[model samples]
Target: MTVALMWEARAVAGRGEELLAWARDQGLSVRPLRRETFRAPGDRVLVITWWDAAYDAELPELPEPEGELVTRPVHRWRFESVEQGA
Candidate 1:
């Protein structure tokens, strides 16, 4: 099965660039099949990683950034791929 993990965070005021850089620099011990990072107008950064594993399987995920760098705690979610319609 294919699983996708989502990590999202909002940086402190005016520090969006730093936050974006920090997210891009993070590394996972077990590399994902694919990874992508995104940013939004609210200084929010989102990272999605695809993995080949069971839905309930243990997997590595991005850690929280330093408290000083963000306005609030990070949010994360996991989802398993479903069959595509023909």
Candidate 2:
């Protein structure tokens, strides 16, 4: 099964773009099979990375952005793929 890491954060007031840009430049120690970033309505950013490992496997993750750029701490989640379609 393939595992995926989902990270999310909200910018402080009007720092959404800056936060997104910062995230874009960050790199993970383990390259992902696929990665994507998204913007939500309320200055929220979501990043998803697909990796070729089990959900419990150890993996490198993007570091937290500088505290000043975010309203709160980043949230992270992991999941194992049970179905996929192309």
How close is every model to the real structure, measured as TM-score? 0.94, 0.93
lDDT of the candidates, in the order given:
0.95, 0.89
Which residue pairs collide in model 2, if any?
none
Give the distance in Å from residue 53's predicted Cα in candidate 2 to where it truly belongs.
0.4
Model 2 spans > 4 angstroms off: none
Give the candidate number with the greatest lDDT.
1
Q: Which pairs clash in the backbone of model 1? A: none
Over the full model, what C-alpha lDDT does candidate 1 score relative to the true structure? 0.95
Question: On residues 1-86, what C-alpha lDDT tens digit does candidate 2 reach at each position?
Answer: 78989999999878899888988888888789999999997789999999998779998888888758988899999999999899
- The CA-based lDDT of model 2 is what? 0.89
Off by over 4 Å in 1: 84-86
